[model samples]
Target: MKHHDLEILITTRKFFACDAESTEEAVKIATTEARKHLGQDFYSLEIRDPSAGWPETVHEATNPEIT
Candidate 1:
């Protein structure tokens, strides 16, 4: 599969803050709770932990495979 640089918008929650496969997944998980905290705060996903690497690695159009 091709790698996609998805811009994820996260409204503070545990999964997105710790573990999530993708932005869409994170949003889906939060959608129910998000209804209550619509205007809360948000953050872009980042590499905070050492064991992390780019969310996933794959060759995409302009980008080559990381490995």
Candidate 2:
């Protein structure tokens, strides 16, 4: 069998409610929370092989009602 190495990219978006006094503080808190909960909220996925060229998107989640 042949083996290959590939890179995967995951895109996620989530909303967080924080008791912060400033926008900067809110962003910090949200970033911390998001890092702690990685891989739990993903809306898109992409894969690419270094040996190959550009990355290819495999999955994407879209909400028609939001637009």
Candidate 3:
């Protein structure tokens, strides 16, 4: 893959964060450390999964400031 500085957007139900770094360095770090913690199952790891679909559509919208 082409090496570039990029940001990884990581998300969970309760939290989200972005990791910004060079891709080549990031892959080296990710592969090295993840293997230590996850063992041979490193490839199938999942951090979290939130709602699997879109939120219910709201017909009426209300401004939080006005409420």
Candidate 4:
């Protein structure tokens, strides 16, 4: 059997709703919340096989709720 080297990349996104006095504060609140939660929405995935000399394949999530 031949061994091959492959690479994988995953991208995710999360949304947070915050009520703050300013945009800066809202961003801060969202960041803090994101740090506390492990849940994320899948955005895209990429896979590459160097041995095959093939272009990477990309799969993107089509969920409208992600945004």
TM-score for each prediction?
0.25, 0.48, 0.28, 0.40
Tell me the tens digit of each residue's lDDT in model 2 across 23-67. 557556655655465545443322223233435332233333332
After superposition, candidate 3 runs with Cα above 4 Å error: 1-21, 40-67
RMSD of each predicted structure: 14.2, 15.5, 19.3, 15.5
Q: Give the TM-score (vs. native) of candidate 4.
A: 0.40
Off by over 4 Å in 4: 1-9, 39-67
Candidate 1 vs candidate 4: the TM-score winner is 4
Report the lDDT of model 1 for residue 36.
50
TM-score of 1: 0.25
Clashing pairs in 1: none
Indicate whether candidate 1 or candidate 2 has the larger lDDT: 2
Task: Report lDDT (CA) for all predictions.
Answer: 0.38, 0.48, 0.37, 0.48
Give candidate 2 misplaced runs (Cα > 4 Å): 39-67
lDDT of 4 by residue, 7-67 (tens): 6545564435668896557655655554455346533333333334556332222335554
CA lDDT, candidate 3, residue 66: 28
lDDT of candidate 1 over 1-67, digit per residue (tens)? 9998866544442332525797555445445443454443332222222235645522111112221
Rank all candidate structures by their TM-score, best first, as comma-separated numbers. 2, 4, 3, 1
